[model samples]
Target: MSVLRSGSPHRPARSLATVAGILLALVSLLLGLPGTAGAAATQRAPEPRHPEQDWAGSQIARHEGTADGGAPPAAPLASVEGVDVSSHNGNVAWSTLWNSGVRFAYVKATESTSYTNPYFAQQYNGSYNAGMIRGAYHFATPDTSSGAAQAAYFVSHGGGWSKDGKTLPGALDMEYNPYGATCYGLSAAGLVNWMKDWFATYKARTGRDAVLYTSTGWWKQCTGNSAAFGAVNPLWIPRYGSSAGELPAGWGFHTIWQYTSSGPTVGDHNRFNGAMDRLRALANG
Candidate 1:
């Protein structure tokens, strides 16, 4: 997501105390003492008390639901609710998320080629433990490093999928650049080339196509509206205000629609284009 965007873009903060705590735990583990990591995983992970209170009350327009728009979609909104999150969300209450009818989640795993979300394991595994279909995504930085290198970094970190029948394929968050240029200093053709490298490398390593999370505007501006990935990669479209709008060049319809960036609960709200059975099939595959 763009740093210029309106929603909580989840800017990363390096907390020395948190790092020191993790280091101490690692040292203890290496010294033959029981580690907190194991305990943290085996037990119910701590849930942020009043997590919703942390909401900045700010939301992106494209993420607003139909109530705010006051106009109905040409077709009914799809069923099967889901959410996507990053560090900006802090500790997620996976139990509450499930109880709230959140059937799935896509957590931010890695960004560019260097940064990985500190809370990836907790969010990803936690959601799975809560019985929600889970997936992970990488924030693409076409300008920072080679796309192949970044994809490798992402998979190694948390973007890899297993055949556990519950892990959704990793998604590539290729939207407006968070840095200086919207297209990250690449021409339209260059952006497409970068995407080709990234997707091919990800698929080669993971044996599954990466989901493409993008908006029509960003796709058009960066990739010159190329629909090359449309057939292979599933489209996760983001459109605000109304339920329907112009789509990116290639796909006739989106497999998943992220209706709002800001929903009643934490993270962005989304829906699968098909029924829950189809969503489950996708997850299983």
Candidate 2:
């Protein structure tokens, strides 16, 4: 799970009022108050009607097959269904997640430098204890200072993959590194070299090939023409919205298509990462 910190490349922070409301709700629940009591706290507050809507809501709606306006139900996860957990969304209740149709998770482990996730221990421990299949991800950093060191740090702090050989392999999160900008910053050849170094070191330590995660644009600009590395490791491509139907050229054989940034799960407002069975098969393979 990559820490989409306040300074991270993607989305901005949530409003203060939103944070306050969530905290208040949590506090009320902790005090053993009734559900209606918590609901009443904002009855006359003139807040947004869907005030409780958060990432978790988006996820629930997506998973319940209600996201696109009375759309048909999504395919079942009897053989393959998964989610990616990160510190940004905090720790999810393992029981709730399992019951909500999630079969596996790729939890965040480390970012650049020594910045290990605050929730890594809790999420990993809870999921593992529950016997859930899991994998780890390292936030890719091109900050010449210690890219390899950061990779090593993630592996060290995030714990190793499940030994039962059922866990998805580890991944290098190369989406939006503030230091590296995007894969565009690296020349096509440079991108290959960088991935080679990272993957080689990762496999040497974990005994599994590193799964490379990237968005469409990043893949086109950084690795579109590089057969040297792309052919060796599995690719996890992220393409949101209707355009998800259009995958990157030359990389049609991706291991995973992160079709939705929002999917249904218990406890959390919206969970991230959902893929088709074909993608799941590739991951499991």
Identify the candidate with maximal TM-score: 1
TM-score of each: 0.74, 0.62
In lDDT terms, how accurate is model 1? 0.77
Which consecutive 10 residues in model 2 have the weakest lDDT in total?
A: 48-57
Which ten-residue region of model 1 has the weakest summed lDDT? 51-60
- Misplaced by over 4 Å in model 1 are 1-78
The prediction achieving the highest lDDT against the true structure is 1
- Over the stretch 1-285, how does candidate 1's per-residue lDDT look in tens digits? 446445666656779988888987887667755577556555774432322211111222322332443222344545688888887887899999899889999998887766777788889999999999989988777877898999999999999988887899999888765445778899988988898999999989989888898877777877888988888889987775556378888888888777766677878777778777888788767
lDDT of 2 at 263: 51
Q: Measured by TM-score, how close is model 1 to the native structure?
A: 0.74
**CA lDDT of every candidate:** 0.77, 0.57
What value does the lDDT take at residue 259 in candidate 1? 72
lDDT of 2 by residue, 139-220 (tens): 6656443455656776787735544644667888765434324553667677667777777777777777877766555556
